[model samples]
Target: MKPTRFIDSVNCAIEGILHATRTQKHMRYHFLAALAVLFTTLLLRVSSMEFMLLALAVSFVLFAELMNTAVEIVVDMISPGYHPLAKLAKDVAAGAVLVAAFGTAIMGYLVLARYVLPWQKAGLEMIGTESETGMVVSVVLVLIVVVIMKARGGTGTPLEGGGVSGHSAVGFCIATSVALHTQDPLIAVFCFILAAMVSHSRLLLRIHRPREVVAGGLVGVAITVAVHLLFRAFG
Candidate 1:
């Protein structure tokens, strides 16, 4: 339908985002990565100029990805079969996204390296006390991993039923992070119990099989623990 008003235009824009997010795994990954980067930036408290640069880098990559998806769709519809020109068009569009992503990665490293490397000065004993960074990284990694799993398995959409349950993964991920940061047995046990309950709920609803839920919980815990250890070692 043609957009007839400002609100209609906004809704149409949102629909495009939703379409890309649902159909394109890379787009979903970019969205999650963008969130993680922005959250880290807030915690790092970078300079205004640095913040603007990071924001622009993120926007550039996302824009490139969206354009790539659009180009591929158009090419497929126009060609609908083997066509060297269509293939070239899609490849060129994909190459643009790849270049944008690479430049964004370099920009991010230049902006964040100074702030992150300073963690070496902090004592190891004191490092575990800060779980914010570890938790954020763990959750983001789990989400990305889940997205990949869903895309590969072709079992479900991004949010609901999948080969691995993202909700379960994130639930257990945060629980493990909390347990590690607190270093209190009581809190650890409580957190695991909550995580288990969350995983079990998926089973109860029959949204996920026992193995899928278990796999998600295990993935969550494994990723979170690895992240915690890395932060402690470097931070």
Candidate 2:
């Protein structure tokens, strides 16, 4: 085939796959799952540069999957007959996807666990739910869930009830904790702004719906309120 024709074919194949990906729920699930995992594992907060690295790695896996599918389709079209070399090529492509996914998972676990483990221990200590401990516990729990969902490929928004709504949950939880710890309205206001931005950004990115964002805001506010009350009770 001519160069133009070859390029056109490649574009058409890509278009078809993307089209199918959007319409096919399963494909979307796979894509979203990967994204969610990266998001939650990295805590999806406006915290650090490590999260950006995690995001890049996850994106690489998705990109590899798309490329692998394209290569396989093109190969099949070129040589319909079974061939050893063709099989080898396909297998190699698949192996690439696996390697990318595995690496992504490992990085996620490392980055997340560094923060998640301690948070888990603290959360388990919130039985009374009547001290700064309670708020800390709530935040830790949310963080843990976010890490798990991200590693496992969830679709929650970090505050609602799904993959990573824990972002909002934990955000609010921390904001409240900070407010209680400092007992300063200015600090509380700052935390609230940061939390709100995180929630809004999640929706703006189209990674979450409106319900998810609202829930995150509410969760943060609620956590703050609860912690304030708990502290007041003890004081």
Which candidate ranks first by TM-score, i.e. highest?
A: 1
58 Cα displacement, candidate 1 (Å): 0.5
Which window of 10 residues has the lowest lDDT sum in candidate 1?
118-127
In candidate 1, what are the lDDT values of residues 1-235, reduced to their tens digit? 7879999999898898899999999999999999999999999999999999999999999999999999999998999999999999999999999999999998998899788744633433344554687789999999999999988988878888889988789999988878667655446656878989989999898889988998899989889888888887888
Question: What is the C-alpha local distance difference test score of each model?
Answer: 0.87, 0.66
Lowest-sum lDDT 10-residue window in model 2: 121-130
**lDDT for each residue of candidate 2 in 129-231, tens digit (9 for 90 to 100):** 3465666665765566456664564554434446445566666677767655655544555787787777777777777677765665576566556555666
Stretches of candidate 2 above 4 Å error? 1-17, 20-29, 38-46, 122-235
The residue ranges of model 1 lying beyond 4 angstroms of the native Cα positions read: 120-235
